[model samples]
Target: MSRHILPPKAGHPDVICAAVGWDRPLQTYYAQVCFRTDDEPDEGEALIWRGTEPGELPTPEAAIAVITPYAEIPPRLAEQLLADMTATIGEKDGRHQAEVKRRLFGSIH
Candidate 1:
Protein backbone atom coordinates (compact mmCIF):
# COMPACT_ATOMS: atom_id res chain seq x y z
CA MET A 1 0.00 0.00 0.00
CA SER A 2 1.00 3.67 -0.43
CA ARG A 3 1.57 6.11 2.40
CA HIS A 4 0.96 9.83 2.77
CA ILE A 5 1.27 11.76 6.00
CA LEU A 6 0.72 15.37 4.94
CA PRO A 7 -2.70 16.77 5.83
CA PRO A 8 -4.44 18.96 3.34
CA LYS A 9 -5.50 22.51 4.37
CA ALA A 10 -3.08 22.24 7.25
CA GLY A 11 -0.10 23.98 5.66
CA HIS A 12 1.28 20.57 4.80
CA PRO A 13 2.67 19.43 1.47
CA ASP A 14 0.07 18.53 -1.12
CA VAL A 15 1.82 16.68 -3.98
CA ILE A 16 4.98 14.81 -4.89
CA CYS A 17 7.29 15.48 -7.89
CA ALA A 18 9.07 12.32 -8.96
CA ALA A 19 11.40 12.93 -11.87
CA VAL A 20 14.67 11.77 -13.33
CA GLY A 21 16.60 15.02 -12.82
CA TRP A 22 19.85 15.20 -14.75
CA ASP A 23 21.76 16.70 -11.86
CA ARG A 24 20.25 14.93 -8.91
CA PRO A 25 19.13 12.20 -11.28
CA LEU A 26 16.03 10.73 -9.57
CA GLN A 27 14.67 12.82 -6.76
CA THR A 28 12.13 10.75 -4.91
CA TYR A 29 9.48 13.29 -4.06
CA TYR A 30 7.16 12.43 -1.19
CA ALA A 31 5.73 15.86 -0.52
CA GLN A 32 2.20 16.55 -1.74
CA VAL A 33 2.87 19.76 -3.60
CA CYS A 34 1.57 19.47 -7.14
CA PHE A 35 -1.32 20.78 -9.21
CA ARG A 36 -3.75 19.34 -11.74
CA THR A 37 -2.02 21.26 -14.50
CA ASP A 38 1.19 19.47 -13.46
CA ASP A 39 -0.37 16.04 -13.12
CA GLU A 40 -1.05 15.34 -16.78
CA PRO A 41 2.18 15.68 -18.72
CA ASP A 42 4.77 14.67 -16.12
CA GLU A 43 2.93 11.83 -14.39
CA GLY A 44 4.41 12.94 -11.10
CA GLU A 45 5.20 10.59 -8.25
CA ALA A 46 5.91 11.50 -4.63
CA LEU A 47 9.48 11.40 -3.25
CA ILE A 48 10.71 10.37 0.18
CA TRP A 49 13.99 11.19 1.97
CA ARG A 50 15.86 9.99 5.05
CA GLY A 51 17.52 12.31 7.53
CA THR A 52 18.46 12.44 11.16
CA GLU A 53 16.83 14.85 13.60
CA PRO A 54 17.33 18.51 12.71
CA GLY A 55 19.11 19.23 15.95
CA GLU A 56 21.51 16.32 15.65
CA LEU A 57 23.58 18.03 12.98
CA PRO A 58 26.35 19.89 14.77
CA THR A 59 29.38 18.87 12.70
CA PRO A 60 30.06 19.06 8.97
CA GLU A 61 29.41 15.36 8.44
CA ALA A 62 26.39 15.49 10.67
CA ALA A 63 25.01 18.55 8.96
CA ILE A 64 25.46 16.95 5.56
CA ALA A 65 23.65 13.81 6.66
CA VAL A 66 20.90 15.61 8.55
CA ILE A 67 17.99 17.32 6.86
CA THR A 68 18.91 15.39 3.71
CA PRO A 69 15.64 13.54 3.32
CA TYR A 70 13.83 16.68 2.23
CA ALA A 71 15.67 16.88 -1.11
CA GLU A 72 16.50 13.35 -2.12
CA ILE A 73 16.34 12.34 -5.79
CA PRO A 74 14.80 9.12 -7.05
CA PRO A 75 17.00 6.04 -7.11
CA ARG A 76 17.44 6.13 -10.88
CA LEU A 77 18.67 9.71 -10.86
CA ALA A 78 20.87 9.16 -7.87
CA GLU A 79 22.53 6.22 -9.54
CA GLN A 80 23.45 8.36 -12.50
CA LEU A 81 24.68 11.18 -10.30
CA LEU A 82 27.07 8.87 -8.57
CA ALA A 83 30.62 10.04 -9.28
CA ASP A 84 31.97 6.62 -10.19
CA MET A 85 28.96 5.54 -12.18
CA THR A 86 30.07 4.51 -15.69
CA ALA A 87 26.62 3.76 -17.01
CA THR A 88 24.97 5.07 -20.11
CA ILE A 89 21.93 7.22 -19.35
CA GLY A 90 20.99 7.27 -23.03
CA GLU A 91 22.38 6.33 -26.39
CA LYS A 92 23.15 9.97 -27.10
CA ASP A 93 26.03 11.98 -25.66
CA GLY A 94 25.97 12.25 -21.87
CA ARG A 95 26.97 15.94 -21.81
CA HIS A 96 23.58 16.95 -23.17
CA GLN A 97 21.90 15.22 -20.30
CA ALA A 98 24.04 17.12 -17.82
CA GLU A 99 23.13 20.40 -19.46
CA VAL A 100 19.45 19.56 -19.23
CA LYS A 101 19.72 18.81 -15.55
CA ARG A 102 21.47 22.12 -14.89
CA ARG A 103 18.84 24.08 -16.72
CA LEU A 104 16.00 22.30 -14.99
CA PHE A 105 17.53 22.96 -11.59
CA GLY A 106 18.01 26.62 -12.44
CA SER A 107 14.44 27.02 -13.62
CA ILE A 108 12.78 25.51 -10.53
CA HIS A 109 12.90 26.14 -6.77
Candidate 2:
Protein backbone atom coordinates (compact mmCIF):
# COMPACT_ATOMS: atom_id res chain seq x y z
CA MET A 1 0.00 0.00 0.00
CA SER A 2 1.11 3.52 -0.81
CA ARG A 3 -0.29 6.02 1.67
CA HIS A 4 -0.26 9.79 1.63
CA ILE A 5 -1.29 11.62 4.78
CA LEU A 6 -3.01 14.95 4.22
CA PRO A 7 -3.33 17.44 7.06
CA PRO A 8 -6.63 18.86 8.20
CA LYS A 9 -7.98 21.98 6.55
CA ALA A 10 -8.52 25.06 8.71
CA GLY A 11 -12.17 25.40 7.75
CA HIS A 12 -12.84 21.82 8.76
CA PRO A 13 -11.35 21.61 12.18
CA ASP A 14 -12.89 18.27 13.02
CA VAL A 15 -11.07 16.62 10.17
CA ILE A 16 -7.77 15.25 11.33
CA CYS A 17 -6.42 13.57 8.27
CA ALA A 18 -7.16 12.33 4.79
CA ALA A 19 -5.44 9.15 3.62
CA VAL A 20 -5.17 8.15 -0.02
CA GLY A 21 -3.47 4.96 -1.18
CA TRP A 22 -3.24 2.07 -3.53
CA ASP A 23 -3.98 -1.55 -2.62
CA ARG A 24 -1.72 -3.68 -4.73
CA PRO A 25 -3.41 -6.97 -4.00
CA LEU A 26 -6.80 -5.53 -4.83
CA GLN A 27 -5.35 -3.71 -7.81
CA THR A 28 -7.23 -0.54 -6.90
CA TYR A 29 -6.97 2.70 -4.98
CA TYR A 30 -8.83 3.98 -1.93
CA ALA A 31 -9.24 7.19 0.09
CA GLN A 32 -10.42 7.81 3.61
CA VAL A 33 -11.20 10.95 5.57
CA CYS A 34 -10.59 10.66 9.29
CA PHE A 35 -11.27 12.75 12.34
CA ARG A 36 -10.07 12.68 15.91
CA THR A 37 -10.63 14.83 18.95
CA ASP A 38 -7.83 15.92 21.26
CA ASP A 39 -9.38 13.86 24.03
CA GLU A 40 -9.63 10.82 21.83
CA PRO A 41 -5.96 10.38 21.10
CA ASP A 42 -5.93 6.96 22.66
CA GLU A 43 -8.98 5.88 20.72
CA GLY A 44 -7.36 6.68 17.38
CA GLU A 45 -8.90 8.35 14.35
CA ALA A 46 -12.47 7.83 13.23
CA LEU A 47 -13.57 7.44 9.70
CA ILE A 48 -15.62 10.36 8.41
CA TRP A 49 -15.88 9.29 4.78
CA ARG A 50 -14.42 6.87 2.24
CA GLY A 51 -14.38 6.75 -1.54
CA THR A 52 -13.71 4.54 -4.57
CA GLU A 53 -15.85 1.48 -4.08
CA PRO A 54 -13.31 -1.36 -4.07
CA GLY A 55 -11.50 -1.76 -7.36
CA GLU A 56 -13.02 1.40 -8.77
CA LEU A 57 -10.07 3.74 -9.14
CA PRO A 58 -7.22 2.56 -11.31
CA THR A 59 -4.66 5.10 -10.14
CA PRO A 60 -3.56 6.89 -6.99
CA GLU A 61 -4.30 10.27 -8.57
CA ALA A 62 -7.85 9.15 -9.24
CA ALA A 63 -8.20 8.21 -5.60
CA ILE A 64 -6.99 11.67 -4.58
CA ALA A 65 -9.48 13.31 -6.90
CA VAL A 66 -12.31 11.24 -5.50
CA ILE A 67 -11.44 12.17 -1.93
CA THR A 68 -10.57 15.85 -2.39
CA PRO A 69 -14.16 17.12 -2.21
CA TYR A 70 -15.06 15.39 1.01
CA ALA A 71 -11.67 16.08 2.56
CA GLU A 72 -11.83 19.71 1.36
CA ILE A 73 -8.13 19.65 0.50
CA PRO A 74 -6.75 22.86 -0.95
CA PRO A 75 -5.72 23.11 -4.60
CA ARG A 76 -2.09 23.24 -3.53
CA LEU A 77 -2.47 19.97 -1.69
CA ALA A 78 -4.24 18.48 -4.64
CA GLU A 79 -1.36 19.53 -6.85
CA GLN A 80 1.00 17.93 -4.37
CA LEU A 81 -1.01 14.76 -4.54
CA LEU A 82 -0.55 14.77 -8.29
CA ALA A 83 3.14 15.39 -7.83
CA ASP A 84 3.42 12.51 -5.38
CA MET A 85 1.61 10.28 -7.79
CA THR A 86 3.98 11.34 -10.53
CA ALA A 87 6.94 10.48 -8.34
CA THR A 88 5.57 7.07 -7.46
CA ILE A 89 4.73 6.23 -11.04
CA GLY A 90 7.83 8.00 -12.41
CA GLU A 91 7.82 10.81 -14.98
CA LYS A 92 4.94 13.19 -15.64
CA ASP A 93 2.94 11.18 -18.09
CA GLY A 94 0.69 13.64 -19.92
CA ARG A 95 -2.17 11.18 -20.26
CA HIS A 96 -2.36 10.53 -16.53
CA GLN A 97 -1.95 14.20 -15.68
CA ALA A 98 -4.73 15.20 -18.05
CA GLU A 99 -7.04 12.51 -16.80
CA VAL A 100 -6.45 13.32 -13.15
CA LYS A 101 -6.93 17.06 -13.75
CA ARG A 102 -10.13 16.46 -15.66
CA ARG A 103 -11.48 14.24 -12.95
CA LEU A 104 -10.46 16.50 -10.10
CA PHE A 105 -11.28 19.90 -11.64
CA GLY A 106 -13.87 18.91 -14.25
CA SER A 107 -11.53 20.32 -16.90
CA ILE A 108 -7.82 20.34 -17.63
CA HIS A 109 -6.85 24.00 -17.31
For candidate 1, the TM-score is 0.21
Best by TM-score: 2
Clashes of each: 17, 0
Report the lDDT tens digits of candidate 2 across residue range 10-91. 6876676777766443345677777666777533375643443445676556777766754655556545545554554532
lDDT of 1 by residue, 1-109 (tens): 0122322232333333322211123222122333224445354343333222222222323322322333343333333333212332333425765576467554221
Q: Residue 77, candidate 2: how far off, in angstroms?
A: 7.7
Q: How far in Å is the alpha carbon of 79 misplaced in model 1?
A: 4.6
lDDT to native, each model: 0.31, 0.60
**Which pairs of residues collide in model 2?**
none
lDDT of 2 at 39: 70
Best by lDDT: 2
Which regions of candidate 1 are displaced past 4 Å? Answer: 1-13, 23-34, 38-80, 83-85, 89-109
